[model samples]
Target: MRVAFVSFETVHHRESETNRRLQTILELLSEQGHDVHVCCAQFWDGERSTIKRTGISYHRASAGLEAPTSFLARVPFVLAKLGPDVVHASVRPPKQALAARWGGMLARAPTILEWYGDGGITNDWWTRRAARWADWIVVPSELVETWVRELGVDEATVEVVPNPIDVDRIDGVSPGDSVDVVYARRLDADANLESLFLALAELRTRDWRAVIVGDGPEREAYEQLAGELRIDDRVTFAGACSLEERLAIYRGAHVFAQTAEHCVFPTEMLWALAAGCVGIVEYHADSSAHELVEGWDRGFRTTSEEELVDAILEAGGLARRDTDDRFASYDAGAVRDRYLTIYRTLQDSSSLV
Candidate 1:
């Protein structure tokens, strides 16, 4: 099958969850003999507009900030020439979703839109228009599925497929102390890092340290909060690290802590769990991330601050169990095959009718 992905950001241009996910998918699809083309923007200098990597073709969108808009404008032309069977997009960028809808129509192909947000955008004029225009909607969790349905998307057009984690890419290395806790994610209030830092402070009685990975707008505030709690010396604000470096950190840690207030299933959590940190942390009351580790016996879960502290202490002390059983369904190949199922279904002439 010929597939053209309409993305504002490419893996080479940006290092993000979407970039990583798309790279995995496109590479796998290309390896499987599918003609995969990624229409995206170039992030750095001397970057060619069209480059091929691992059998996938990447066509740079534009030279300006309005690249996504300009790229969408050319999707029809590109699709006309490439004549792909499917056009993939996302709803995060309202403009890209809207444009992909129009481009798919121009190319007479089915456009699949991944809606990762919990809020229903169906009521918003532009979002609703894009949602209506999208041929099929793919969401990661049931929570998001319900939201998209409430937004007036056709029920038959929506499907739930969790994102994939490159299990082989992660390192399952837990330190001997087992009190080495790590928080790997963007530093945002929504992440509930305030609660995490406070909980870490409470656990100061133990000989433990924390490695906070990733950088975001809340960096300064989190740093200040750590000082106020007097646990600054025990924590390391590592900022962001490369994927290999991140996996190594997760492996060396005994526990991975996450405190999200509201979030779709985070890809970071999946990678951490895969890398063998006896994951600990309660799912935010309003978050869908809880679903990721709901039944896994390899980690811990809690809701309140007290429970979080207790879980951390308990899980940190416990020996690492075989995490293979927990990540059975999330294997990179298995998840990619599930997506392949969707693509094949859409490609079937009967499904269109």
Candidate 2:
């Protein structure tokens, strides 16, 4: 089967979860012997042509192209020319969905629309229309399912699929004996890094070291908070690393803590669990982290700074249990089979049609 992925920009062009998922899905399909072509928005440093990386074939448009214009104008040409068995347009919230619809109509191919963000509460009509046009809708968590349902898409069309991760890359490292708390998220205003810094300040007397990875606008503010609390020496900021380096940090740390005000999916927390870290999260009732903590009792959950501090201290006491088996279902090999099943079902339906 030939699959065409219509992701405008991916890790091949940008370092992001959307791009990572697009690349991962392409690799998995390619490994299963499907002819996979990834059409991407181009980058500056020479990734505009066809390049094969990790068993997946990628094709890119020119650099600095706007999402709206390019999706409407350029994508149809690629779809008409490639002639794939299925066209998958991932995370089409606005204009991209229209392009995907047009592309599918012109190519006469079944299209799968994927969205990982929350729905329902947001009053975005374009996305709702896109949901209607899609042959199938894919989301990472049940929280997203609720949102999609509210958009009035048929229940049969929406499918719950976990975000795929390279579980083996996070596996097999023995956890350190001393308590090391790790947080790997963009240090932006919405990330709520201040709460974590205050919590860490509360834990300065305790036997623990807090490491914050990734960088953003609030780095200086967070550093100031750490300095004010006099815990700056104990807290290390390891800003933005390669995939291997991030995985190495996850394996070396004993606890993973995050305070995202409102995130649809906590990908970093999942990685921490897969990496054998005792997970701690600060999430309110409406957030997706609540769903994660509710399902997996392994992690500690809190909403306030005090509660977060207590949870961190509690995480120090929690015994490190083997988590590789629990997260095995999310491994690339297992998820690849799951996706193959979806593709086969799509193929069978097309054959009947």
Clashes of each: 1, 2
Poorest 10 consecutive residues of model 2 by lDDT? 170-179
Instruction: Give the per-residue lDDT digits (tens) of candidate 1, residues 9-99.
Output: 7657666555665677787788778889877665546757787878988776766445566766775676666677888886756678777
| TM-score of candidate 2 on Cα atoms, chains taken together | 0.84
Candidate 1 residue pairs in backbone clash: 173-251
Name the candidate that leads on TM-score.
2
Worst 10 residues of 1 by lDDT: 170-179
**Pairs with steric clashes in candidate 2:** 8-41, 10-19
lDDT for residue 51 in candidate 2, whole number 0-100: 72
RMSD of each: 3.6, 3.4
